[model samples]
Target: MSSDSRRFVSQLAHNEPVSQVFLASDKQLRPNRNGNLYLQVDLSDRSGSVNTRMWNATDNDYKAFDNGDYVHVEGATQLFQGNMQLIATRIRKARPDELDEGDFITLQSADIEKMRTRLTEILEQIQSTPLTRLAKGFLKDDAFMDKFCRAPAGMKNHHAYQGGLLEHVLSLMELVLAVAPKYPQLSQDKLLMGAFLHDAAKTDELFYDRDIGYTDAGQLLGHMVIGVSMLDEKVRQIVQQDGQPFPERLLIELKHLIISHHGEYEYGSPKLPMTLEAIVLHLLDNLDAKVASFSQLMADCPNSESNWTQYFSQIGRKLFKPEKED
Candidate 1:
């Protein structure tokens, strides 16, 4: 199919026919109640993703492609339990000639470079000598920087595309700059560094060459644990190179920010936000993630005729779409 005929996932409406190529992930072949097998997967473009099902599928169909491969899908979309899903008639590995790389990338190369430059400028603004050295240590690691820019902030929620991690961090850093000025007692440098480091280890935690998924380290330790370890490594490097002792209290506070940013135990925070800076970081992190996720849901909602989006089980409510002024 040509680009002109393509219907992106975000543009799909209820009861529309779908014939296009998409990046496939989270695939499974399972038996139904009657012992008939069906194929289940998520079909995605840069816009967003939709859950898809192919009935009466076989083992051969499941083996046709891997999780990250591009596939051609012949389907129709329908509203199922207030959410949009595709019912596929045919599915197969897409031919090389049928692919468009730009369709899958959320951010272009130029966008990522611009974000990286902004990130560097923000880090350079840090006034604390020890924290500044630590930030520079992470910046100078070419391998880590490359992965950090390419990694997604998450697998399915906010900023779940390549270069998304960088985008989220940069946005959060900007939030710190804006909010910190109003709260004069909070250290802007600490909040900025915390924002940058909070999700920095996601570069190592996730494998994002194609489909985003957890690495072995990510599954076992998660980003918070890995983040503390990463911070320690950079701190050690700074101390070894400068031939000086890093401040013990400052190091503990930085680690506290990382470990407590989740905000609660059920949310995976290892510790409560005891410090004022830690509390602010946790709230800011949550505010940014939720706003981004909600905004994406509004953009990707398929019910064009409705004033409200389809009920999202993830957030447990439907989102209202503001009427556009002419």
Candidate 2:
């Protein structure tokens, strides 16, 4: 919330006149050696996090709060045993949304229209008949296009912010288009479409909270299965209207791209990449997702850049290495 992060962090760092915050952690109540009820809150609101605690089981602050309310606590920073913590004196949830929602979440600064235009450009460049039509059907759906373009590549890790998936797709397309002119052995058309549509149902597939969370569809069907189902429906509609044959073999291959984009069965693929384009698409998709995750990690935690960088979990390994300061 535009609660001046620099000031809040500075105050906490300096142990100045107590700080106030929302976002209390949901941990079970426990008694300290002093026999006071202790509650710790993992307080964060887009700026950063602070661990805060309420002491005394019978205090007015404890009785006044039911233990999980978003409390505005007056507290000074203290090192409890070893880790950083706040010794809270007062506690209560603050007034609702003192700042706008926009201030509370991370977002891409890219032009949405330009990104949409870029996505359109990729669609225009496709020459494969079935893939081209599938791409167009998706791009033309107003509701799906809006959500897909605005949706993050993930709920976390790589492109976790709004328009993240588009950014990922755009990045992969750049590589695909560049490689097209050089590597004629690969089917550029299918590769590009595969990359663009690989995560299409992610628009409906992945769950996003303040960030994206896994929906039931996401957890159960996943984007791989969901994307295939969605495209299959669209293909049926297109055939119904025009009575066109969308190349059965190519349709299967496109389905393969969706089903196998995860690259392996355990990784979520029902089948490994069967066609040439599917293989390249899987690798390229993975390459883009990883590089982007590392890039964001470096952006978020510059201090940790020296030894190892911590990113949103999907990256698995901590990205290590700091940039040279100019």
Candidate 3:
């Protein structure tokens, strides 16, 4: 059945089997929680969102079930803890083709292909050899390219979802070009590679199945670490096949770009950006992510002169309607 955007939870489908169900994802996990416990779910459909919770004490969210698994939320809509959450009596895995495309994931309605065309145009303008080659190889893979283009750059924070990676990459590159000219201290080539290839590993690591699900690699190593491994492996392969000396120094510096892109070790970086490019990449990444998340907040929910939303941790601000300009 087609999930109407207007209907977040079908009062009619309350007792029926959960036909058009949106799945549970790791995106809902709160910071401090017990192992086997109930979870507050971000039940998303194109229309809007409803909070879902599994109240059954026997549930195993920390062990058996996981984030990003498709599940049938079968039960009735009931208020719990003063919130609108579906009180699920039973929950089971949802499979592919079990839902209409629109019901399962939230994506910008913009044309994905057009986004790709524009992304490729920016990529071709890159002058660094390894950066150019890396971008080309990733964009060439039919399956990977499709997922990368469509996947959110992140589950939250910044450019999140299909075309999100491309958009974020493009934004970082623009920032680098605009800023690099002023700082002769920064190697343009190194900065470009670090900026362009830093997140390329996310193309493979993150799988947007159901709702921005991580592949096994993502679950384990994360995009930054996996990307460095990917780069190292590819460099080894290139050096082995041909006796030509690969740019080892350039490659090492590029690795730093990925390692320090997260800005802090705990956040996932090996070190804060020592090189100018690394610093720039981190700052621009933060800027773009915060702006995108904030923009989404403004667009999805308006002030309406009625209500204001709680502070968004991603954007670190309360969501409010933008004032109209004459």
Candidate 4:
């Protein structure tokens, strides 16, 4: 594949001929109506993704490329069922050096440096001594900070792009600060600490240095448990440094916030949110994630002229995008 110039998936238009290389985010081999085998691949760039069809493909052709591999694709965009689809004429794996890694990885569009500063400011605003120490412990860890600043919040759910975890954390912190005043019973310290640590282990849960996927521990133990473990370790280190034990009650409560932030057991929380702070954290965390997911869906909606998006399996409803008049 020649690396002359590349067009992003977001820039594609209907019937536009394209000969570009993109990261193969996903792959599936399926049978059409006549029982003909075809390859379905999700091509992506730093911008967005598009589904492509490689018809009349054999098992060998399907085996040639795997998800997370960069592939040189020759295709023309077409409207399929009112969505943009790529009809691939040629597909083959591209060399690693053929494309820049930064070009394929989708990053949060926000100013990361500004977000980092805001993150520090929020951490500083935590009044609880133990909680601020714990937050700073994490912020000081270079390895953890690097991963936190780059890891996606999930593989596909809310904040799934690079630097998404930080964005999610900062947004939730900002939201909690805005709403906490009305609910005086809500501990600002606990809420802010919980917001920062809620998905902290997502740094370990997701492997996004290359492709966004789950780590072995992420699949087995998940982020909640991992986060509790992380908290335990950090608390131990803090106790070691300060020569005073981290308060047992505070430790227990913080861990509870992390594990129970999911709100419901079926939704992956090990325990229900029983405390006022926990309940508030659950509501705000869920609110930010759901709203971010909805925003992402709307932004990625293919039909620009349509006022509604396709059905979303997560929410079980298609979102209405009402047009604005001048």
Candidate that beats the other on lDDT, 2 or 4, i.e. the better one: 4
For model 1, how does the per-residue alpha-carbon lDDT over 266-298 read when each residue is reduced to its tens digit?
998999999999999999999999999999999
lDDT of 2: 0.68
Q: Estimate each model's TM-score.
A: 0.97, 0.74, 0.72, 0.88
- Name the regions of candidate 1 deviating beyond 4 angstroms: 1-3
Better of 1 and 4 by lDDT: 1
Residue 106, model 2: Cα distance from true site in angstroms: 3.1
lDDT of each model, Cα atoms only? 0.92, 0.68, 0.65, 0.85
Write the residue-wise lDDT of candidate 4 on 120-170 in tens digits: 998998887778788888888889888888888887778777888998999
Question: Where in model 4 is the C-alpha error above 4 Å?
Answer: 1-7, 11-16, 28-37, 78-83, 95-102, 108-110, 324-326
**Candidate number achieving the greatest TM-score relative to the actual structure:** 1
* Superposed Cα deviation of residue 242, candidate 4 (Å): 1.7
Q: Evaluate residue 209 in candidate 1 and report its C-alpha lDDT on the 0 to 100 scale.
A: 88
Model 3, residue 22: displacement in angstroms? 2.6
lDDT of 1 at 306: 83
Worst 10 residues of 2 by lDDT: 5-14
Question: Which candidate would rank higher by TM-score, 2 or 3?
Answer: 2
TM-score of 1: 0.97
lDDT of 4 at 321: 87
